[model samples]
Target: MTRIHCLVAAVLMSLSLNLQAEGADLYPLSSPAEQERFQALTEELRCPKCQNQNIADSDAPIAKDMREEVHRMLQQGASNEQVVDALVARFGEFVRYKPQLEPRTVLLWATPVIVVIVGLLVITLVVVRSRRNTETSSALTPEQRRRAEQILKDAEAP
Candidate 1:
């Protein structure tokens, strides 16, 4: 009985997993160029509801509506930039998977590069400082070495 229950649960879980994939819309377009544009736009735009997913891959209602809007705009002969701009205006820049390079997003875009540069500089400074300290400390005079050895010998004496 337990084995039967496990099997039923596994089947149901698999069906639920596929439900999202099955929910994708099939929009019609006029030409291959338009079809390519539609595909590109849908795949490029992120779903507001599914933060990590694009509209083409997400099953969210908002994603479906966005996809429909993209299709309608394309059919109305809107340029790709116009369609994207309209969506961005409606949903804010969060809808764009790749944000435009502007003053507001400059810090976000530059953070990784800034971090890497700082890390490299820190490593270089540490290495150079360590080498300099080693060089200075290792330059012990012969007299100092003899005195240090005598001190060690005296310490080890009875």
Candidate 2:
């Protein structure tokens, strides 16, 4: 039983070591500060190829390039803002996870609001026109009223 316990402990230790080794090769950032900055910046940036995912979370070639660029910028003593600005300059605002609020982006942001307002106005106009038509056509001609009364009397007789 003691031998079996030792074997189990050795297997657990090996598994832990293997898992650590797998991650060790992945984070190429030289220092903890650099790694943190790289992660923050990448997570904030969009991956162009995988538009739904941030750079750090994507496995695309562009994401890898972006990660490498982050490392390079960190080595050059560039601040997070500076790195992000550089990326925005090179890749445009579309590369950012959060698009900047600007005149260029006003249409993208305002289109839905404008459409909703127009839809409401259209519905209001339709309802108003229908209501007005109903009111205006409420009164029947004398001949039409007489015909309606005759039809109702026939229906009741049956």
Judging by TM-score against the true structure, name the best candidate.
1
lDDT of 1 by residue, 96-128 (tens): 888999999999899999999999999999999
RMSD for each of the candidates = 4.8, 4.5
Clashing residue pairs in all predictions, respectively, total 0, 0
**lDDT of each model, Cα atoms only?**
0.92, 0.86
- Per-residue lDDT over 72-141 for candidate 2, one digit per residue giving the tens place of the 0 to 100 score: 8888889998999998898788788777779999998898999999999999999999999999899899
Q: Which TM-score value belongs to model 1?
A: 0.75
TM-score of 2: 0.73
lDDT of 2: 0.86
Colliding pairs, model 1:
none
User: Which consecutive 10 residues in model 1 have the weakest lDDT in total?
Assistant: 19-28
